[model samples]
Target: MPLVALVVAALAIGFEQLIQWKYGPMGIIAFIALTIGLKAKNTAISGLGAIILVMLLAQSN
Candidate 1:
């Protein structure tokens, strides 16, 4: 249903905003890259984004 899809999208946007607030712009960039890469079916882009996310996680602790 369109309403369900809209709600999911709104939730996703809010979640992304939370991530950005907590982790900063790089987090947003990394997530965007990961999402886009997966959608586009590009392994290299996805791998790079995964690597960045891993690094960010490591740095957090």
Candidate 2:
């Protein structure tokens, strides 16, 4: 259930980026939701990693 939400949130972020939408802090919230849903230390860490990767790419412009 939570993993599903996480994926949805991630996809949403991706779409927003595709359309050049600017959302401040929403990505952090999504990452938090994903971490909680993951319920594993390693998963949470990886989720953060993925979020950072996305954020970096988003800010590259």
Candidate 3:
């Protein structure tokens, strides 16, 4: 499931890049993806998603 995790993580990153921000739907999706990944026992997915999510939230006003 590492591959799947990577894919999901990639999608989150793509969404962040697509919207050019992570404060809206992009952030929400990333968080959801993280939750799903962790729940599925894919630490890689959770790690990657958390990194992006943290970055996004940290930068938020």
Task: Evaluate model 3: give its TM-score.
Answer: 0.55
Residue 41 error for model 2, in Å? 39
Instruction: Give one digit per residue, the lDDT tens place, for model 2 in 1-61.
Output: 9999999999967865653444445555555555565666567666775676477567867
TM-scores of all candidate predictions against the true structure: 0.88, 0.34, 0.55
In model 2, where is the ten-residue run with the lowest total lDDT?
18-27
- What digit string (tens of lDDT, one per residue) describes model 3 on residues 19-39? 445377767767777878889
- C-alpha lDDT of residue 2 in model 3: 100
Worst 10 residues of 1 by lDDT: 15-24
Q: If both were scored by TM-score, which would come out higher, candidate 1 or candidate 3? A: 1
Compared with the true structure, the alpha-carbon lDDT of candidate 2 equals 0.63
Q: Rank the candidates by lDDT, best first.
A: 1, 3, 2
Q: lDDT for every model?
A: 0.89, 0.63, 0.77
Please report the candidate that would top TM-score against the real structure: 1
lDDT-wise, the better of 1 and 2 is 1
Ranking of all candidate structures by their TM-score, best first: 1, 3, 2
